[model samples]
Target: MENGTMPSYFYFTLFKDFVHMRYLILILTLTVYLAILLFNVIILFVVFKERSLHEPMYIRISCLSVNDLYGSAGFFPRLMVDLLFDTNTISRTACFVQIFTIYTFAVWEYTILTLMAYDRYVAICNPLKYHKIMNSKVTALYMALASLYAVFSMGLAIFFSARLPLCGTDIARLHCSNWSVVRLSCGNSTLNNNIIGFFVSATTVFLPAFFILYTYVRILIICQKISKEFRGKALQTCIPHIISFVNYSIASFCDIALSRYDSDKFKFVALFFSVGFLVIPPFLNPLIYGLNLPEIRKNIACLFQRSKVGHFPK
Candidate 1:
C-alpha cells in the first residue's frame, strides 16, 4: 500500500477459514438468492399486472420489491462466485460500487417505507382527501425526491470515502463497506468521516424514522376517536408496514453493532449480523405484504390461477 493511493483490491480475511464449507454454503446462497429473486419479482409482477392493485401503498411495495432485487443483486452474484471459487478478493471499483448500491438501496427503502406510512396516515386520518393527496403524480414526485436524496447522500458518502488513502486491503467481513474502507486509511480521516457519516445518517435514517413515528401516532389518535371496526381496518393496513419497518430497523442495528464491535471471538454472530440486513428483508417483505394484505394476496392468487389454467391448456 502506498500513501494517498487506494488499494487495487480488498481481501475478505474471514473467507479464508470458510473454505471447507464452501460448496455447502454456495448451494445455500444460491438457493436464497434465487428465492429472493422469485419472491420479489412475483410481487413486482403482481403489482404491475393487476390494475386493481395499483394504489399508492401497493405501488410503494412494488418499489420495495425492486429495491430488494437491486440490493440483493449487488451482493449475491459476486458472493456466489467467490464461494464457488473460494476467492475472497474484490477489486476496488467493484467494492465501492457495491457500497454505493447497498447504501442507496437501504436509504431508498426507508424513504419508500416513510412514504407508505404517510399514505396510510392520509388514508386513515384524512380519508376523504386521501385520493387527492396521494394521487399518482404526487406519488411519483415523492418517489423521485426520495430516489434523488438516496443517490445524493450515498454518493457524497462514497465521494468522501474514495478520497481517503488506504494503507491496507484486508476487510474482516464478507462484503465491502464504507466504514471498512475508511478504517484502512493511513491518515487521521476517521474523525472527519464520522462527522460526515453522522449527518448523513441523521438525514437519511433518523429523520425518516421520526417522521414515521409521528405519522403512526397521528393514525393512532385518529383511530381512537373512530369506531372499533374502523380502527381494526386501519391497523390491518398498517400491520405489514409496521412489521417490515421493525424488521429492517433491527437488522440495521445488528449491522451497526457488528461494524462497531466485531471480533474473532464472536465470528458466528458477526457473520449473521453482516448478512442479516441483506437476507431478512428480501426474504420476509414479500411474505409480510402478500399474506397480510388481502388485496395483494388475492391478486397473487389470481395470477397463479391464471398461470395454472393457461398451463393446463384450458
Candidate 2:
C-alpha cells in the first residue's frame, strides 16, 4: 500500500458497516409498512365483498382505508429505497413530484376524515334524515370534491415550491416535504410559507377539526334527548371517531411544529409521531368499529369462513 493512503480493506470495512445499517433500517421500515398496508387491504376487501357493509358509515370507512393505503404507499416505499440503497440524492423534479404526491394524499385523508365525521353526525343526530343526507349522489359529490381539492391544493404548493431556486446541500430530513424543501431555497421563502401555511391550516387542519368537534357536540346533544339505551349506543358509536380526532389533532400539530423547528432532535421526534399518527389510526379504525358494531364482525367472520371453505374443497 502507499505510505499516505489507507488500505482497501479498511475502506471495505467502513462501507460494509454503513451498508449493514442501511439494510437493517430498510428491513424494519418495510416490515412495519407492509403490515399496515396489508391490514388496510384486508379491511377494504372485507368491506367490499360483504354486501351488508354497504351502508354510509362503512362506505366512509372504506374510503379512509383506500386513502391510507395510497398515502403510505406514496411515500414510505421510496423512503425505504433511499435509506437502504444510500441513494440519498433526489433530482429537483423528483423532489417536487414527491412533495406534491405526499401533500395530495394528506389532503385527501383529512377531507375523508371530515366526511366520516359528517356521516356519523347524520346517523346519530338525525337518524330520520340520515338516508336522505348521505345518499349516493351526495356521497359521490363529496368524494369528487375531495379528490379535486387534493390535486388543486397540492399543485399550487408544488408550483410555488418548485419556482424557488435551490442552492443548499443540507436538507436534514429523509423526505422532501414542503417546508423542508422551501427552507433550502436560495431566495426568500416567506411568501411561499405564508401562502402554503394558510391554505394547509384552513383546509386540512382547522376546518376538519372544527367539523369533527361540532359534529360530536351535536351528537352528544341528541344522545341526551334519547332513551338511556339509545344514548349508550350513540356514545359507543362515537368512541372511534373521538379517538381519530385526537390522533389527527396530534399529527396536525406535529406537522406544523416540524415545519417551524430547526432542531434535528425535535424534528425527528415530530417525524416519528407524524408517521405513527398516520399509520396507527387507519389500522385501528376498522378494528374499533368492527368490534363495537356486531354486523361488521359477523361479516368478517363469514368472509374468513368462506375463504377457508373455498381453499379446502375441490
Question: TM-score winner among the candidates?
Answer: 1
**Residue-level lDDT for 87 in candidate 1:** 88
Off by over 4 Å in 2: 1-20, 265-271, 309-314
Root-mean-square deviation (CA) per prediction: 1.9, 7.2
At residue 13, give the lDDT of candidate 2: 15
Residue-by-residue lDDT tens digits, candidate 2, 207-303: 8788888988898888888999988877777787677668766775776776677645564464465456455665576667666667777777776
Q: How far is candidate 1 from the true structure (C-alpha RMSD, Å)?
A: 1.9
TM-score per model over all chains:
0.96, 0.86
Q: Report the poorest 10 consecutive residues by lDDT, candidate 2.
A: 5-14
TM-score, prediction 1 = 0.96
